[model samples]
Target: MFIYQKLRDSILKRQLAPGNQLVESVISDKLNVGRTPIRGAIRKLAEEGLVNVIPNRGAFVIQPTKEEIVQAYEIRMELEQLAARLAVPYMDETDYEHMQRLCDEEGETIQSSDFRAYLQVNKDFHMTYIRKCANMFLIEFAERMIDQTNIYLMLYEMVFFHTSPQTAPGAAEHRELIQIFRDRNEELAGMKVRSHIANAMKSLQIDNIQFSNLGDIF
Candidate 1:
């Protein structure tokens, strides 16, 4: 899990950008681990949709296409809306406070002009609430989808749009959604979640960009 998290973080932070060939030997040497563990970690990440494995070729980071982004965001929208609907009835004041703090932290990160930190915090904020939905299956499913979506955003979405400026609006939306949750308005929460996803899709336009899949790096 640690290795996978480290490698995934590197990819998400663009430290290991798309198309970078992942050499298992090199990674094992760097992390001072045996080939077996690194290989296992790679397989786990692949299952999480963070890496692509080609039969004879080596593994490589996924270079998301516009179409892939659209599909990811659409799926995220549906799943998140469902999560929010389920979460509302079970939400507590503590959860609300934690979400509020997350929003504030996100806002601060955005204002500080730290895009990487802001992105991490934004993800944290979403996960914090999404977990409260109390549906392990749904939470796990949404997490995987979100991870895939992040890969798309990190690799391709920023190429076409200025993602930094959108952070503030995204943070604001989180705040609004939290407020709706606090009010126990499941309907409004659902609507807000849908709107947030729609707005993100429109802003990112993952379906319009051109990308060529460099078939099976690994």
Candidate 2:
């Protein structure tokens, strides 16, 4: 898990640029771990849609396409809305407090222009409610979908936020949704989730701006 998290954090932090190849031996030597664990961690990342392991070529960080981003968000909207609706009945005061704290943290990130931090906090905020759905399979699937979108979010961080400084992804909508959750209005909560997803999708400016080559070393 430590190896996996190290690799994952590196990718998310843009330390390992998109399309950078993950060399097992280099990573194993640097981390002082065996090649077997490195290989396993890479496979785990591939399963999470963070890495692409080709048959002959090595695993590379994912560079999501415009179409792929759109499709992922579409699926995410449905999954998350359903999650919010199902979670309304299960949410407690503690969940609301945690989510609100995430929201506050998210606001701070925007002020600091730290979009990456905002992305992580945003994920936590959504997961707070999504986990309460009480459906293990749904939670797992939703988490994967969310993780996939987050990759795109990180990939296009500058283009998504800097180009339009006014667009703060879900900063306000998240707080509003928290209130909807507190109201225990399942349908309203679902609607707010749908709207939040749509707003976030609208903020993104998708293009063929490549960040790195797959031939690049990690």
Candidate 1 ranges with C-alpha deviation above 4 Å: 1-17, 20-50, 157-167, 205-218
Estimated TM-score for each candidate: 0.69, 0.72
lDDT of 1: 0.73
List pairs with backbone clashes in candidate 1: 53-218, 54-218, 57-218, 58-218, 59-218, 66-206
lDDT of 2 by residue, 148-209 (tens): 78778776555434532245556767888989999999999999999888777776554534
TM-score, cand. 1? 0.69
**Residue 54 deviation, candidate 2, in Å?**
1.6
Which 10 consecutive residues of model 2 have the lowest summed lDDT?
A: 208-217
Writing each residue's lDDT as its tens digit, candidate 1 over 1-218 gives: 78777777676555665666678877776667788888888898788677889999989877676676778888898898889888899989898898888877766665566666765776777787689898999999998877666656555444223434355567778888888998999878878988987775665543354433222211
Query: Counting only residues 3 or more apart in sequence or on different chains, how many pairs clash (N, Cα, C under 3 Å) in candidate 2?
Result: 0
lDDT of 2: 0.80
